[model samples]
Target: MTTDGFTTCLWFDGQAEEAAHYYVSVFKNSSVGRVSHYTEGAMQPAGTVLTVEFTANGHKFVALNGGPQFKFTEAISFQVFCDNQEEIDYYWTKLTEGGGEPGPCGWLKDRFGVSWQIIPERLDEMISDPDTAKSSRAMQAMLKMHKLDIAALEKAYAGE
Candidate 1:
């Protein structure tokens, strides 16, 4: 067996190549890698795309054209930690474009139905603070917003 580290595999219904390219375009340190095609006696057409290996934000992934038997659900989501509101907004906008739906509390489903959580890096610190009042306020602020706002969360944490 290969001793490779964990690589996430995303199941797609004949959209493996498209998803791989889209993910690579959205991320900074990303690139599309090797692509595998179906062979004779395979479940799909012999020349059809089987899997597309890619690296998005330095994370390895494989987009598989595994048919419509499987679909992505909110049960599994990718969390993008941002240093500031600009980063959060950028990711939120890009991920929510082209038929993507925005959910509550920084959660959104991309065009391909993949869920993502764009959150501020400081959110954990604010929510986990020893002061219950501050943490509670921060949590309240977060609950009301779709895309996370760092400034608002800070203000709430400070009781301002």
Candidate 2:
């Protein structure tokens, strides 16, 4: 892993700790990391969690109780490359439990309002197929879906 990895910092109004824990529980290979606290008088409300680092599915994220000046949007999204339909379905189901909204092209917003794309591995291949017609069909099929159906994309590619 020569590429240096960086964590995405999330600014939560008052739920940094709760969000960190929730994310840790959702992903495999995840764990809560160093939790730094604000020393007395350091923050407006002292004793708050200044930063809580957590890793989910091997990706690092830091949640900070940084007030409500900013919020998340769909412009940036985490893409989960799932090898099979089972993995895709599992993530899609788990992430949408609270207020997560399922969108077209395998995209969803978790309860935390963070965007995620649960994509099938084969879908990329199909979209890149040498045959333009096959690729077009697969692309068209993907555009109509919420949680992407791998089988449907395959069927579209096969002209079914």
Candidate 3:
């Protein structure tokens, strides 16, 4: 509760603690914060974890151990913007471990069904280039990618 801002709350089926641990381990400058348990709830038993506050690269989040009444979709996601391919590869590999699935344009769904966008900062530089032709080529290249190859995007922007 040190930092003051909006915290994103994630719903999970009794895996909030585990997810918090996993996420803090993946992102830099992250850690788990306060943990609260329920006293009497229809979903989970008393004494079970109700909410866990955590952080990822300075962004705050709260995970709730809600029941299976809800499920995660692609409507919302946490984006990890990397400056280079190495950082991008590190996040991509770690988040996709276990039962994760890869999606096009640097998108991936983790084991917990949470969507993540592992994008390189250069992607924007290329896609937003002043030259319309170069930007269009970069967009086309990005549309065909999974993990997002920064080198390929640069190549497309250069029209080579």
Candidate 4:
């Protein structure tokens, strides 16, 4: 109904502010916006951060200090489509640093437990090719990699 785009809300246990700043630092064209604090009689202490508004890579997000009841899982993840190996490597390294866990097929959990997919922009085209053989090779190659290698995937797609 409304023309306003959606804003993704991330829940954290007393880390809303910290996460907001961290995300801003990691992304280009990003900055921290409004920060709301809890008031008297709130679940959290007065003056404690309740939510932090931030923009990362031009996407609106709100980080909420919603306590420890909720945790990030792999079921939901953010995908970063990269133009080349360098872009993939940059995102993978930055996201996986500081205790982030690398998963299969370019999936990884950052230090804050947020799952991310650092994938090449062309990966979808390769994996979804009409030719089964080429697509299968690319899929197999991707399955074996933690951080995606664009050249390797391309080679596989070409049956090289």
Candidate 5:
């Protein structure tokens, strides 16, 4: 881990480039940085994609062609902090397209089987409100949501 920056490497079954393209298209401030192909002497077949570098909403990531031996799980996910409902909706819709599945509490699995958390920035503050009752209401609201509703959370926090 260098102080220069950090990258989250994603393992794919020979879909590094495809996944990179998909991610770049979905994220607001994202793009593919590099695409490296394997050559002779590599574990994968020659001329196959080896690794890809990309940015999803400014987060550096490396997608590797590590074969299908491993898979993405719910244990890890990229959490996107959004300012409002529109941002949340955009992310949720784009990320859950194709074969993606929706999960409780603003979690969803993309077509590539990558888990994503489309979270509202204010949700944390509301859930940790100084008033315990307000915080409890916020928590209850959040637990019942698939795609977070910021207004609903605010209303609940206000005991309405």
Candidate 6:
């Protein structure tokens, strides 16, 4: 991977343009990129968009209105490593707009049906503690919640 970074392409049935714009509006440092369309009599009509490229949070993504043969699954997800609770809460709230649902370990599905994991960077230390008892407590604490609470994780790690 170059310093330029990598981008992920999301396939939408026919809402590529709309979805691209929506995502660009959400994250900072985001903008819609090139838009290409199929020529007349091509696979799709001339005015019909063939691809829409967009960037969000500095990550690039292409939305292809390639029909409905594929859909987003839980197998793939975006991970948001939050350094503080405010950031976590902000992302969680914004992401859950519409029909998004919160899941364990800070996992959530956005209104657009995109899965995301909003977690604190400190979680690695808490879960990877050399002490098995502390690790167990942290795991238990983590399993019971949807949006991860950094404070609670820290408390558990400290045996508080």
> What tens-digit string does per-residue lDDT give for candidate 6 at 50-146?
8998888888888898887888878999998899999999899988987788877789988767899999988888888899999989989999889
All candidates in order of TM-score, best leading: 4, 1, 3, 5, 2, 6
Candidate rank order under lDDT: 1, 4, 3, 5, 2, 6
Candidates 1 and 2: which is better by TM-score?
1
TM-score for each candidate, following the candidate numbering: 0.97, 0.92, 0.95, 0.97, 0.94, 0.89
In terms of TM-score, how similar is model 1 to the real structure? Answer: 0.97
Encode model 5's per-residue lDDT on 44-92: one tens digit a residue. 9898999998988888889999998999999999899998889999999
Candidate 4 lDDT, 54-109, residue by residue in tens: 98998889999999999999999999999989889989998888999999999999
Compared with the true structure, model 2 gives a TM-score of 0.92
lDDT (0-100) at residue 3 of candidate 4?
28
lDDT of 3 by residue, 65-86 (tens): 9889999999998888999999
Off by over 4 Å in 6: 1-5
In candidate 6 the C-alpha lDDT for residue 5 amounts to 62
Question: Residue by residue across 1-160, what tens digits does model 1's lDDT show?
Answer: 1228989999999999999999999999999999999999999989999999999998999999999999999999999999988999999999999989999999999999999999999899999999999999999999999988888999999999
Highest-lDDT candidate: 1
RMSD per model, one decimal: 1.5, 2.3, 1.3, 1.8, 1.8, 2.3
lDDT score, candidate 3: 0.92
TM-score of 6: 0.89
The parts of candidate 4 lying over 4 Å away from their true place are: 1-3
How high is the CA lDDT of each candidate model?
Answer: 0.94, 0.87, 0.92, 0.94, 0.91, 0.86
Pairs with backbone N, CA or C atoms under 3 Å apart (clashes), candidate 5: none
Where in model 5 is the C-alpha error above 4 Å?
A: 1-3
